[model samples]
Target: MTALTQNRHSPCIGICKLDESTGFCLGCGRSGDEIGAWASLDEAGKDAIWQLIPERLQALSVRVRLLPYAGGELLDWVGETIREGRGTWVAGAPGAVAEFPCHDRDATVTRGEDELTAAMPKARFRLKGSEKLRAFAFDGDGPVVLGLPKRRVALPMAEVVTPLGPDEAAIDPEFRDHELFDIGVARRASRFCVRTGDAELIAALRAAEGRHWTELMAKTGATIIEKSPHRVVETGLARIEVFAEIPPPGGTSPTGPHTHLLAEFLTTGEEIPAALGLPEYAAPIAIFYPGTPPA
Candidate 1:
């Protein structure tokens, strides 16, 4: 099938206003380059970016309040708050619908339009028309509405809270390396869920905490179920301690403190991607890992 024939629909809304402070278009939640390069990109690239939009929108649309309790990582604390505040929703393919509560068996869940179903366990349902299959859940108390297209994707996820802001945004290079970019991938996907109001599917994300991204991938088998609430730290800006290496002695002999060189570029005075050695149109996160570990 042609590329256009196989994929879902385009996500652009045509508003096209770029937000300079965040480097994302206020309308579509995409970078200028992404908007310009949309036609040239393959379906895979489009899908990847489509997945990232919701997270960006979530960060921009939602209000993040720092939890008062201090201890452990902030993301972990946020995760705990989520688990305490909401119920758990698990996402998985049952191989056959028989494994789950069918419409005939459970009146609460009846199949809706275009293979969409409603009232499943924990208020979760499956979504169709994508290259991959997916599902979602929501807090029973709030309006059971899903957000999309217009920018607002969904309500506050019961189990995950994304702390969004320039000060709260940033990447922990150490943690990123530990997950090997898998968490990075999952973070975007989780944001998509949060934006789209897929609570049950997001609830499934709780399982990935404290585990390596590879392990989570193995456990889920590429079903698009991995999740982590911590990626906001990687996405937004925060006080990141950029360490630098001490140069060798003037005599051309290596210094005793020389382990490795780690350099980070930052200008507290302004927010510009170019200062960080990135294209003017690139995402602020495009230059996230610039240098090595400090000596």
Candidate 2:
């Protein structure tokens, strides 16, 4: 029973040629190439270039964009604590597991700034067969930087969006705390569901949402998003877009303010393991990568 480790084949397609005008790569799906070509292109061309690109795509890859804290908090779930009842996903467990410490089925281990800063270089060590990194940044596939056990895990989650400021957005509590992390662990265990379609899946998400809300209401004895209408929109003939402004598993107020890692799932009456590049709801340990919260 081993824990999850790095993929030897990083989603790195070594295409580094930048398209100066588009800031994107004809080689890779990046956006830094076109800045140099800007003067030569029409304003319309520049407008059409990056309608949907995230401001940070130029600095992201499948490895880093999706999972940035590969070294720092990446191994937060992988450790002897799997047996210590500490975090959630215990390292060597086989076949659909949850984070190591259940912690009452509704609590989270805090990886607050102090913890992260202290665990610094040690957390940066790479796992067996994985390459090490120097100075982990949000741009590249951050440091593998740790001796990790290889195992597939999943998480369960529900997102609650909040306003950070006039422009910036971030997850509440500033980051994914323990409860949120468990969703990932739950995903792999058939213990979680993150579906977007199908009456049953929708019902499940609603149930998860309800459970979360009810727990919060019970704890804080306050009402939040309880009045917001949770519904679906017809995005396509057979596909409907479902959305809700629920809160994070931890509580009502977010840490700073920003969007969370919410996504749309398409169900064809079959088990979908993914939502676009995002992992399906049943992911054991969500690989969350919080960025510089909007200021």
Which model scores highest in TM-score?
1
lDDT of 1 at 227: 31
> TM-scores of all models?
0.25, 0.22
How much is the lDDT of residue 209 in candidate 1?
50
Residue 230 shift from truth in candidate 2, angstroms: 26
Pairs that collide, model 1 = 137-199, 137-200, 147-153, 153-195, 169-236, 169-237, 170-233, 170-236
lDDT of model 1 at residue 161? 25
CA lDDT, every model vs. true structure: 0.29, 0.26
Model 2, residue 214: C-alpha shift (Å): 9.6
Backbone Cα, N, C clashes tallied per candidate? 8, 57
Give the Cα-based TM-score of candidate 1 against the true structure: 0.25
Whole-model alpha-carbon lDDT for candidate 1:
0.29
Residue range 1-295, candidate 2, lDDT tens digits: 2233333112223445655555555333445545456456664554444333334454434332322223433435333222233322211112221111222223233344222111111011112112221111234532211212213322222222111111111122221121111122212222221222234433333344434423433543222234322121100000111123446556452231112222122112212122212222211212112222111
Error of 1 at 109 (Å): 4.0
